[model samples]
Target: MKVTLPDGTELQLEEGATGGDAALAIGEGLARAALAVSVNGELRDLARPLPDGAQLSIITGKSPEALELIRHDTAHVLAAAVMELWPGVKISIGPAIENGFYYDFDFPEDAEVSDADFERIETKMREHVKAKESFTRQDISVQEAIEKFKTENQDYKVELIEDLITNEGAETVSLYTNGPFTDLCRGPHATDTGKIKAFKLTSIAGAYWRGDAKRQMLTRIYGTAFLSKEDLAEHLHMIEEAKKRDHRRLGKQLDLFHFSEISPGSPFWHPNGMKIWNSLHELWTEQNARRGYNRVKTPILLDVDLWKISGHWDKYRDNMYFTDIEDRPMGIKPMNCPAHIQIYKSERRSYRDLPIRYSEDGLVHRHEPSGTLHGLMRVRHITQDDAHIFCTEEQIQDEVIQCLRFGFYIYEIFGFEPKLELSTRPEQRVGDDATWDRAEAALENALQAEGLEYELNPGDGAFYGPKIDLHMKDSLGRSWQLGTVQLDFSMPERFELAYTGDDNDEHRPVMIHRALFGSFERFIGILIEHYGGEFPLWLAPVQAKIIPVSDLFNDYADQVAQTLVDAGLRPDVDARTESVGKKIREAELSKAPVMLVVGAEERDAGTVSVRRRHNAGDDDAKLTIGELVDVLSAEVAERRRPDAG
Candidate 1:
């Protein structure tokens, strides 16, 4: 038989030779380093036999496939260590995740794993790695696998195998063995345990067997592994940095927002936080005005009939919050599209009035699971920067491009390079294939025309249409999805929305639903983390802090603040009976972008000392009032879009 290597080299080998044999034929060095092989793009273990006249690529320790194998082997080691420490603990399943691996187990009633057990587990894992036990894969019939797990009293394993056999029509299952430990898995694990050189168990938590709340709770042990010690240290440091910038902590320190038991997933905006909100809203309104969008308001609660007509009742009912209003069902709007459709249908339109862009700061409520709610990232009640564009089918591409450009403009203001994603229709979508195909093609063309690269997320779109998702990466390299543009043919058809064409015939107008800032609460949360509570000059709640050096400068400080306020800036005067140094330190702690120091000399001279928030080691610069305003105005404008360059 002939085998082809990645470099197009062909070697004649015995028919049905294993990948290991092929590697050995290539070179002794490759054979020793080979962890797995990809035969015709399918990853398989070295023990798997290669077909006749096959193309193969041997994967070594440096390849991503080899890294996955190492992580999988580490999970098996972890499970083995747990079972060894506490006899009678039943292993369920272990899988390799993006960053690391985790193993779930159902331990004995009296035995519960905690942080203290991590050191012992780590020691056991290292011992296994040092032993260099080879991983062996075995294939057995479903009935045999079930019987083996049942006999061992491993109910979770048995249950999983039974489901796979019944639902997936599996005739056989694969199991991996290392020394005395065995786990049910479909794997291409590392050649041996020695490959797991740098790994650490990070934390422990409780998880459901299959993520169902009512299912049996299992102990999930999480850990991460890297190819080298230095890489592991760097990863750990990145995690520490992310912890320091966690928005929940910064929100409290900055006094921006808070949550209470009365409203579990809702945010209470304080004065400072509301100031930021108002500024964002003002900017939004100003931008939309330039884009020819008409600002509109709609009812927060709508009757069930409206939702039914818009198809929200059928598709999005699970996430919607409904109430009984005088014995009539009313839903707190979970989205603004249906309400926008209602407004569109309120008036008859002609081709002259085509392409109506309606904008609203719509407050919505969705019933999110309690476990999924985070500080401000995930919440129940949110105000969406919602807009709907109603236009003829021919206008789809241009409208989409315009929306993308608008989204780019918004993200660029925060110094974020937006990542784009195109989501196609789901299996249970409403539109016909022709409509979906057209819509998807239009979105793709628009994105390509704008020269934006995007990832395709199959079957992740709304039921009504395909969508474009825009994500922003923060300082810690975490991506947040904050903008979306969805194309909808279903809503217009369902609502029977039509605009007269040039031929005087009524035709259904396509609808495009879009939001630049997905939710006010979540975006603010991201901004807090992105800027570490030191918002840009334009977005800062208090752009400037006027610090009076002494009580003698109170009137001057108040006048300075008034001048700033009159100049369309949010400024505050600190008149507390405190030392100048203390006031400056407090201003820095509050993350005020600019601190204007007013002393008797500066008061008399109509000048002030300017201190930058992030300049911890810099001296203050003295400037006249006009000069100060000019510098601050530039800073504020730059904060609006410092990355425009």
Candidate 2:
């Protein structure tokens, strides 16, 4: 039999030769370094044999695939350690994630793992790694696997295997063995335990099986692995940076917002926080107005009948928040498309009025699971910067392109280079084959016309449509999905939305649902983290702080602050009886973009000592009050985002 290498070279090998044998045939060095093989693009263990003539790419320790193998192996090691110490714990599933891996286990009644057990587990894992135990893969029949796990009293493993066999009709299952530990898993693990050069168990949390809250909760241990110690240290440093910029902590310190148990996924915006919200809304309103979008407001609660007509009640009832109005079922709007359709249906339209764009900062309520809720990132009540465009089928591409351009403008203001993604039909989608194909093609052409590269995320689109998702990178190099443009053929049909065509016949108008910033709450959270709470001059709640050098200068400070406020800046006067240095320190800590020092001399000269946030100079430059306002206004008008570069 012949095996093909990545470079397209073919080697004649013995029939049923494993990947390791092929590697050894190539060279001794290659065989020693080979960790796994990508058999025709599918990763497999070194022990897996090539079937007939096949293309294979050997993975080494330096490859990303090899790193994933190491992390997966580390998870098995950690699970083995846990079972060794506890003796009766049942292992469920362990899988490698983006930064690391996690293993879930069902513990004994009296034995619960905690932070204190992490040290012992880590020690045991290291011992296993040092022992260099080879991972052996074994295949067993479904019945045999079930019997084995049932005999060992591993109910979770047995249940998992049974479900797989029942649902997927899996005839045989694979198990990996290392030392005294064995786990049910698929192939593509490291060649041996010695490949796990560096690893650390980060933390443990309670997770329900398959994330269903009603199911029995299991202990999930999270850990990370790297090829070298230095890489591990760098990853740890990046984690520290993320921790330092955690928006929840910054939100509290800045008096921005808070969450309460009564409203698990809702936020209460404080005065300072509301300022930020208002600023963003004002910008949104002004931009949409310029873009030919008519600002509109709709009812927050609508009759369930409207939702039924719009297909929301049937499709998204699980996430919709329902209320009772005089015994009639009413739902808090979870999206703005239904209401926008109502507006479009309110009037008879002709071909001349074909593209009707309606924009609104719509407040939506969704009943997110309590466990999935985060600070402000994931919330129940949110105000979406949403719009819907009613256009003819011919206008789809142009409308989509315009929406993409608008999204780019918004992201560019925040110094973000947007990443685009084209999401196709989901499993539970509503459109017919031809309509879906046309809609997907329209989105693809729009992206191509704009000359933008995008990833195709299969089966992640809205139920009603395919969508283009826009993501932006932040200062910490983390990406956030902010904008989306969805092409909806189902909603208009469901709502019976129609317009008179040029042929004088009524035709269905295609609806394009878009949101530049998915939700104000989540976007604000991302902005907080992106800027590390040091918002740009335009977005800062308080752009400037006026500090009085002494009690004698309090009046001057107040006057300066009032002048700045009248000039369209959010300024605050610090009249507290603190030292000038303390006041300056407070302003710096608050991340105010500019600080104005008012003293007897400056008050008499009608000038102020201006200290810029990004400046490192020790000297404070003196500028006239009018000149200062001009400088500050220019900075704000420029709409410079935080230094993402």
Candidate 3:
């Protein structure tokens, strides 16, 4: 049979030859380095038979797809090592995630494994790699696979095999063996365990089976792998830096917010935290008002019929909270669009009134799993910077570009260079073909008009719309999906929303739902980590901390704080009866952008000594009250960061 390589090289091979045979036929060096084969653009195990007249490319350990395979293969090694160390440890599924892999297990009731066990497991994994174990793959009948796992008392494997057969109608399943270990997997792993050169087990946690709360909890072990040691070291360093910047820790240390057993996944903002919220809120409202956006407020609980008509009941009901209020089916809004639609339908509108922009800092609730909740990052309660633009079909492209630029402007202000994604129509979306086509095309065109590069995310659009997702990269180079500008044709049509056209005909308005700061809470979390809690003057909760040298200077500090307040600056007086140095230390720990030290000398001169938090080796500059206000207010008005302070 004949095969074509990625480089257009043709080779002849025997009928029963595998990818291994084809690589050898091409060249010895290629054959030696090949981890697997990409046949017709799909990865396949090297031991699998190659198809005739197919396109094949060799995959090495250094290839882009290598990380997933390496981590997955490392997971198998982990399981083997664990079972060897302690018998009767039933292993569940282990798969690669964004940057690593995790395996869940049902440990014996009397025994437990924790972080202490990671080193022992890693040592055994290295031994397996040192042995250069070559993976052997084989296919077994579905019933036989079930029986095999049943005999081993691995109930999770048995349940999975049964699901594969019953739900997917699969007749056979593949099993891969490396040394003395085997797993039921559809794999295109590295040819030998040695290919995974650098790896580490990072953490352990508890997870329910199949992510179902009703199911039994299992232990989950997470680990990451890389082809080279240098990459692994860099990754480890990032992890350490991320830990230091964790918002949950900083939130408490800086006295920003707190969570309670009284309300899980809901943050109770301290006065300090509310300061940060107010800062972002004021900025958002001022800028939006300048853009001709009108503010509106809607009820938090709406009748269920509104949700049903908006397709939320069908699509997002599981993530929603429903209740019966006064014998009427009511739901706490998971999103503001449906309620905004109600506002749009309140009265008749004219084509001249088209392009109506509605903005709100609205509170919403979603039933996020408790396990998935992480401080403000993934909260059940959210205050979203939500806006909906109702415009004519002719104005679709302009509105999209406007919202896209708005989101980018916010990111740019926050010092983030954003990555964009244009998500197209999904398979199960509402609306007609023409509408989807126009929505998708307008989004793509808007992105292109700005000379921005974006990824086409297929089949990931919202059910009622296609959208462009804006992702911001943080200080650690991790990308987060923060804001979206979605174009929808279904909502107006569903609710029969209309305006009198120029021709005097009732026509539906095009809806553009956008959220620049997706959730104020989540954005705060991102900002906390992005700026490493040393927020800029405009966003920092405590813009300035006024420290007095002794109780004698306390009255002067109070006067200074009041002057700052009257000047529209947020300043707090440290009135505690403590030493000046101790007060300065606490002020620094608070991460206030500036510290104003008031002593006898400053009190006599009617001035304050200014010290910037992020500046080093700079002596405190003595400035009169008027002089300080001129300098600080300019920096705060310009939203200058700490370095500028």
Candidate 4:
């Protein structure tokens, strides 16, 4: 049989030879480093036989696919160790997640396991890695596989097999065995346990089986693995830094916002939080206005029939909050696009108004499971910086480019470098293939026209359209999806949105859904962590704090505060009658960007001593009140970052 390598080189091998054989045929070193193989773009186990003329790429530790495989193999080792330590532990499923892996297990009632048990489990995992247990795969009839697990009291495995047979029409199931433990899986794991070099069990939590709240609760153990010790150490350090910069903790310490039992996943924004929100809103408004976007407001609750017309009733009802209002079924909107469509259709439009942009800081609601909700990142109530552009088909590419540019501009102001991704249609979308092809092509062409590089995210688009998604990397090197521009043909067709053509004939319009800051709540959460709560002057709730050296200087502090307030900046007078040292310490702790100390000398000089939080610079630099206001105002006007001079 012949196989093609990634570099277009052809390799000849005997029939029925496996990927491991091909790797050895290429070189001895490759075979030793090979973890798996990608055959014709599909990942396969090294022991799996290669087909004739298949394109094969050997995966080594340096390959991007290696971490997932290593993490998955580490999970298998974890399950093996758990089963050995606690006999008769029923394992449900284990898979690699972002940066790590987790396995769900139904432990016996007599067993007591927690994070405290992580050390012993990790010790056993090290033993497995040291033993160099080879991962062996076997395919068996569904009945035989079920019987094998049933005899071991693995009911979860039996249920999984039954579902696969019923839903996917499977005739056989694959099983992988490493040393004393075997699991039902379709795997492309590392060649052996020894390939897992550096790993650590992170934590444990209770999770519902299959994420169904009604199903049996299982104990889930999370762990991360890396191919080298240095990588693992770097990742562990990032984890510690992430904990210190957690948005939830910062939110409380900064008195930004808080979640309460009165409103489960909704935030009660404090004054400080509102200040940040208003600053963002001002930016959002100014950008939209400059781009010719018409701001509009939409109702939160609308009749269910409206949703049915938009296909949200069929496609997104599960995630929506619905109510019976006046005996009419109503849905609390999970999105603003549908309502924007109605506004476009409210009156007749012409080709002259081909691109009618409607922007909204729309409040929306969605049904989120209590367990899945995080501080502000994942919430039931949301405030979307949403917009819809109703444009002619001929205008799609340019409008999409404009949206891309708009998103890039907003992210730049926050010091984020965004990466672009073109997401294609999903399997369960509403649009036809031809329409989908056009939408996807338009987006790709726009990116190409702008000379912007993007990744292909397959089958992850919105239900109505293909989209260009912008994922920004924060200061901590963590990526977050912050913006999206979706090109939709289905919704306009569904709503029968039309405009008069130049020839006076009616023509269908294309709908582009865009949001730069995906949601105010989530964006703020990211900002909190991105800046480590030391916000820039423009976005900081308290731009400057005025501290008096003594009670005699309190009057000067209040006068300086009034001057700052008149200059359109948020300033607070620290007249608590405390010592100057304590006031300075408290101001720094509050993450105030600037501190102004007014003493008798400064009062007579008509100047204030300035201190910067984190001492970025300018400690004890005295400036007159006018000079101080001018500098602070310029920083706020330019939206300068705290770290930037």
lDDT of 2 by residue, 1-645 (tens): 998988989989999899999999999999989889888889998998888788988899877687778889999999989989998898999998889999999999999679888999999999999999999999999899899999999998888898898899999999999999988898668789998889998889999998899999999999999888998988888888889889999999999999998778899999989988888888898899999899999999999999988778877899998889899999999998888888887889998997999999999999899979999999999999999999998899999999999998888888776888999999988878898898899999999999999999999998888999898888777888889898888888888888988899999999998998899999999888888888988889989899988999998888888888899999998899999989888899999888999988898999999997867567899999999999889877777654632
Task: TM-score for candidate 1, please give it.
Answer: 0.92
In candidate 3, stretches whose alpha carbon ends up further than 4 angstroms from where it belongs are: 7-17, 21-32, 106-110, 140-173, 207-218, 313-330, 369-371, 614-616, 642-645
Report clash pairs, candidate 2. Answer: none
Best by lDDT: 4
Model 3's lDDT to the true fold? 0.89
Tell me the tens digit of each residue's lDDT in model 4 across 1-645: 999999999999999999999999999999999999999999999999999999999999999999999999999999999999999889999999999999999999989899999999999999999999999999999999989988989999999999999999999999999999899999988899999999999989999999999999999999999999999999999999899999999999999999999999999999999999999999999999999899999999999999999888988899998899889999999999889988998999999987999999999999899979999999999999999999987789999999998988898898898899999999888767987887888888999999999999999997878888899999989999999898887888899989999999999898998999999999999999998898999999999999998888888888899999998999999888898889988999999988998888899999998988877455589999999999999998888866567
- Each prediction's Cα lDDT score? 0.88, 0.89, 0.89, 0.93
User: What CA RMSD would candidate 3 show?
Assistant: 2.9
lDDT of 2 at 594: 85
Which segments of model 4 are wrong by more than 4 Å?
14-16, 48-52, 87-90, 138-175, 182-185, 208-216, 301-305, 313-331, 424-441, 457-463, 616-619
lDDT (10s digit) by residue, model 1, range 397-466: 9999999999988887787768999999999888799988999999999999999999999999988899
Q: Extract clashing residue pairs from model 3.
A: none
